[model samples]
Target: MWAELKKGAAVAVWFMFLTLPIMVVKVNPIEQTVVWRWANLVWLGAAVFVLTVVGRYCSRHRTELSAFWPDAHPLLAHPQLKRFLLIVLALLATLFPLFFSSYQINIMTTALMYAVLGLGLNIVVGLAGLLDLGYVAFYAVGAYSYALLNYHFGLGFWAALPIGGLLAAIFGVLLGFPVLRLRGDYLAIVTLGFGEIIRLILENWNDFSFGPSGIAGIPRPGLFGLTLSVDDAIMYIYYLVLLLGLITIFVVNRLRDSRIGRAWIALREDEIACQAMGIDKTKTKLTAFALGASWAGMVGVLFAAKTTFVNPASFTFLESAIILSIVVLGGMGSTVGVVIGALVFILLPEYLRAFADYRMLLFGAIMVGVMVFRPQGIIGNPRRRSYPLPMAAADQEVGHE
Candidate 1:
């Protein structure tokens, strides 16, 4: 029975994919009729109906389905299967734009960038156990850096990208210096203030940032002076964001498995113990701050390039909260979990188009539900089998500086 349902879902997924294009194009029932727009909604309803039936059937035969699609089962936990499925999913995502509209590709591009951002925050909050509420400040810094460099100095998007990252890193270090003395709630407050300060500066500093109006007409990324604007350049941007997402994941995973990762874990679990074991807390914490900031910076640069216009409005305390929420909802210290969280937080809202007015209400309710029922997150950290990412060595001798 389980096997039958597992096979059914697999079949249903493929069926949906094959039928979607046809349904979207040919199923214009209301066009000749009176209500074309309503007819399109009807078609959407049909698609949902089919998907619901597939879900119900799959749920009914769980036991046999678990045996066949073992990767879907908790007991059949296999890393190899997980990796295989992830690879397949990545390939599908990479090719999705080929069949999707440019509009859809743009949405996916946003999702991918946030995935990278979430991955970066995962390092600080998940691995390093730092509670940073001002992460978006780094993102804002990166975006503004790119905009300023490109607009003021006549630099291209490609040239501005890394420079933006470097500037964010510098600010991260600068911010880390003063806040290192605080911890837990105090640290969170300071970071929160830090983010607000950046926003205020951008808002008031009309001489540089143009205040509330923000900097516009920023150049888009290009390849060898070839801009992506005229054609389906959105698809090209999607690929670029996808590549950055993949790199963020790869680099994070590698970091998690190394000695640096171990030190971070040590610091996260117990800073005092880590110190007793000759670990340098200051250095470890600073590294976490720096790396996390750098990640945000890179995303910020891409975001500015992608949007072609940015200002203080885009990077707010609420934005920081959402990004941090993705880290929490996805399960801290879990890369794939964060990605999943990013998708849910970033893309799920779009799916709720009908409930536009109640979107925030529903989001708040879901967040409360998650906190109450599964605070550990959907993909909670496994008990064992940690990654082997490297880290810089902690000072062996007594070194507070």
Candidate 2:
């Protein structure tokens, strides 16, 4: 016990020292003053100490505690309970805007957009085992598609929606062709470079992408050509995103159960084995890329319509990381888990504005904890099917044969 306490204290002290500059010292350049937030240091140290102790305890007894984990809870395993919870959640979502303020609705709309993006990336990374760090390029394609089309041709949201997705799908195919033979870290680096290249082109091409100032004042979605008030518009976008999220969930779920989806999973597990089984590797990979990119593009259109603006800065590597994190933090290949992960990741940060300065720190810590304790994610993917056999009968049949 004393050894554990000592270790925890050491960790707490190290963290406190590491965070000293950010959490303890505040310097005002204009006023030429430096203030010491010693209280923050104390709080940080205490919190870290407690967390360290708890983490150590959990690690030591992980096997014993496995049965008590959220995913393993007997109540959560009940089919009827699952249905009841899902129905209740649906009802709450439908009535959300009615009770919540527009600000909250807007936040939820953004979260839904990300949820869709996560689901799209799940198709590639989770199902097909493709590490696409340049996923945001497709998102940028979608947003910019809508923005540029509206700017140049007076195209509206509805028309640009499909166009954006189609354009992104083409881009996905283009990207897919080049990276067909790449895998692992090589694939990640190439995708990262691809994303940066897209951003650079947008930033440097002044004539084409408005030179980083970005095109603004893009109109929101219209309802029969009627203009809505700001609050009404927020609510409208929320519902639109809600509907889109539902559609994405349904499509992804179907894809998960399809032959192609199984092929993708097989490819993810063992590419050579998948080929041995007569699966067309090239076609399967390209399909995953194209489908994933299409969803990002569509959500990109939604993002632009909601924000009423588009710029190169908004679609960065950080955005890709966040989307990818959603997939990791939620169970990869689990649609419901991805949605829950998105809401927790996006909404918790918004509500915890008081800890704005420590946001990234907290995020990193939580990710580390999850990786260590729940590598399968907050809601790991459950086995969808099982084959049962009667061993005695099988043995008798074999004996008779």
Candidate 3:
């Protein structure tokens, strides 16, 4: 225990020392470039200290921490209560805009966007058991598809939405082809490289992509020649995202209950067994990638239309990381879990803007703590049944966690 505490403290110190400049420091050519602020150093020290203490404590009380939500466990197993809670949540979400201000509605819209992104990634990483680190590449593809189409061809948002998704689905196939046979870290590496490749291409190919300066004057979404005022526009985009999020949830649920979903689950659990059972691994993987990418593509259109701009910077590795984190944090295969995770992570930063500089620091701490104490995530996949075990085995599981 003493050795572990020392190691944890050393690791925390090393991380703060290394990433302080990169993550906590800021520089912008468009704004005040190369400006160094000393405030973050204090916050960094505090963050590191807190993380080290929490890490050491969690290491010791692993079992106690793992059983933190024992009361909620039985509730999760109850179908009627689960359905009731879901209905209440749906009602609250559907009527949110009416009770909130436009700004609040806009925030909810962003959360809903992340929810969709999280759901898409959940299908790939959660259900298919594939680790995709560069899923945002597909998001960039979708956004740029809409931007280029609307820019030169005079296409509307609705016209570009499906086209953009289709194009992204094609890209998904292309991405899967190169890394289809790879698994674990190898697949993650390729996907990460793929995302960087897409971003770099966009950054350099100024003629086609407009580079870092970005494409401006992109058209906002319109409904059949009905141009909404700014106030109405916020609500319009909010409802648009809300509708898409619902559709994504519904479709993914249907897919989860389908034969393909079962095949994907089998493949996830044991690829050798799945292949022996005559499951076509390649097609199953490609379909998973395509479906996930398609959702990202559709949401990409909504994003571009809402912002009315497109830039390579908008689709960075950080965006991909956050989306994937949401999926894993939310409990992968649980749609409700994804939504809750999205809202918590996305809005936590928003609400804690008073400590803006420490936002990422706090976020990182929360995620680390969760992983340390609750490895299965907040609302772990409901379908993954945990058979009651002997006390010895249960205690062992808790220790491992």
Candidate 4:
């Protein structure tokens, strides 16, 4: 205990010194003045010390804790209780917009959009085991598809939605073909490069993409050609995103239980074993990429419609990192976890505007803590299927034994 306390104190002191220039000292370059906020240093040291000690304790007792709890929640294991909780959550979601302001609804709508993106990426990174750092390139494809179609041909949001997804899927397939043999770091680098290439094209090609100025005054999604007021539009979009999120959940759940999904998982576990087991690696990879990209593309179209604008800057590498973080921070293969992760990540930052300067610092700290303590993620374990042998087969095996 003494050694642990001493180590924690050392870590805290180290962190305080490392962050002194930024957290404790503020410089006014214009006036050539320096302001020292010593209190921040104290708070930082205290926080780091507590977190280090707590983290070490948890690490040491993790096995014992796991043995005691066994399940994440005992009540959650009961079907009836699970059903009731789901119903209650559904009610709350349905009534959310009625109780909150448009700003809140808008923020939730963005969260739902990210939830869809996380689920889509989950297909590739979580299921297929592909490390795609350029996932945002497909997102940009979808956004640009709608913006350009609408700009050049007066195409509406409804018409461009599917088209954007299709275009993004094509881009996904194109990307998949080149990296078919690549794996691990090589694949990540290629995907990252692909993303940068798309962004650079959009940035430099003014005649094609309107350059950095972007396309604006894009129309919002319509409801059977009926016009809506600003508030009504916000509410409408919220509902639309809610519906889309539901559909995505259903589809991803089904896919996770399907043959293709199993194949993807097998591939993720071992490519050689997957191929040896008669799974076609090429087709499996292409489908994973295509399907994942399609979802991103569709969400991109919605993003364009919701904001009424599209630009290259909006689909940067940071966006890809955020989406990837959502998948990782949530249980990668768990649909419900991804949705929860998106809500926490998107909404928490919005509410923490007052601590904007410390937001990234806090985010990094939380990520490190989670990685060290619960690498499996918030909802780590996904459901697995069991196959039971027939009585005759069991008897035959027993007799042979």
The lDDT of each candidate is: 0.81, 0.90, 0.86, 0.88
Candidate 1 residue spans exceeding 4 A from truth = 1-76, 383-401
Which lDDT tens digits does candidate 3 get at residues 1-401?
A: 67766776677678778877876768887876786766676677667867777867876786688676752487766999989988998899888888899889888899999999999999999899989999999888889998999889999998999998998899999999888899778999899999999999999999999999988888889877988997788898998998999899999999998999988888898899999999999999999999999999988888888888989999888898888788777776778888888998888878778876776666576667667655557777767745444875788669875
Question: How many clashing residue pairs appear in each of the predictions shown?
Answer: 15, 0, 0, 0
Which candidate do you rate higher for lDDT, 2 or 3? 2
Error of 2 at 370 (Å): 2.3
Q: What is the lDDT of residue 250 in candidate 3?
A: 94
Over 133-215, each residue of candidate 1 has an lDDT whose tens digit, in order, gives 99999999999999888887888878888888888889888988888878788988998999999999999999999999998
TM-score for all models, in order of appearance = 0.76, 0.88, 0.84, 0.89
Runs in model 3 deviating more than 4 A are 1-65, 76-80, 386-401
Q: What global local distance difference test value does model 1 have?
A: 0.81
- Compared with the true structure, what per-residue lDDT tens digits does model 4 show for residues 56-130? 898788668776544256678799999999999889888999999999999999999999999999999988989
Model 2 regions more than 4 Å off = 10-48, 70-72, 384-401
**3 or 4, greater by lDDT:** 4
Q: What lDDT would candidate 3 get against the real structure?
A: 0.86
RMSD of 4: 6.0
Q: Better model by TM-score, 3 or 4?
A: 4
Worst 10 residues of 3 by lDDT: 380-389
- Cα error, residue 139 of model 1, in Å, equals 0.5
Model 1, residue 192: displacement in angstroms?
0.5
Question: If the candidates were sorted by their TM-score against the true structure, best first, what order would they fall in?
Answer: 4, 2, 3, 1
